[model samples]
Target: MALDIEQVRHVANLARLALSDEEIAVYQEQLSEILEYASSLAELDTEAIPPTAQVIALPGVTRDD
Candidate 1:
């Protein structure tokens, strides 16, 4: 989904950002592209993949309590 200028302005306002017209235009395109990429990722099939908390093994760091 593409973001409109108004939506970008609202988001910037919420984040307390002071953006110039150029900046808003730049961010509008960038943020919209990011959302589009994420939307594409959402279409991926990962049902056969197992959920994981970590990809590598890690040793315990805490001592006996």
Candidate 2:
């Protein structure tokens, strides 16, 4: 699932950005790593755990830690 230069270029174009070829290549690697990390997290096993509303301590929402 390597992010290619064309995809990066398209995203830049949609955002009205004017990135050079070097910048596009750099963003491609960074974005690909981000997506891969998210994909890995999706594979975690947490079926027996209860759901919480908040990850941090808030006024009313439950805390995960």
Candidate 3:
């Protein structure tokens, strides 16, 4: 899913950014690549995978008074 120049401009506008033509072109390509990668990930089989909040367990850090 490649992003067009207009979409990139809209995203920049939403972020309140003022970008030059060159910057917009650069961002357009980068953002499109990210979306394409995410789209590919969405096609994977994850039915056996379980959802979790964190990958590693964290020990308690608070000290008792």
lDDT of 1 by residue, 1-65 (tens): 99999999999999999999999999999999999999999999999999999999799999989
Q: Candidate 2 deviates by what RMSD? A: 6.0
Residues 14-58 of candidate 3 have per-residue lDDT tens digits of 999999999999999999999999999999999999998889999
Each model's lDDT comes to 0.99, 0.89, 0.98
Alpha-carbon TM-score of each model against the true structure: 0.88, 0.76, 0.82
Between prediction 2 and prediction 3, the one with superior lDDT is: 3
lDDT of 2: 0.89
Order of models, best lDDT first:
1, 3, 2
Better of 1 and 3 by TM-score: 1
Model 2 over residues 1-65: C-alpha lDDT tens digits?
57888889999999999998889988999999998999899999999988997787668566788
Measured with C-alpha atoms, the lDDT of residue 9 in candidate 2 is 91
Angstrom error of the Cα, residue 38, model 2: value is 0.8
- Once fitted onto the true fold, the runs of candidate 3 whose alpha carbons sit more than 4 angstroms away are 61-65
- Prediction 1 TM-score vs. true: 0.88
Name model 2 segments beyond 4 Å from true. 60-65
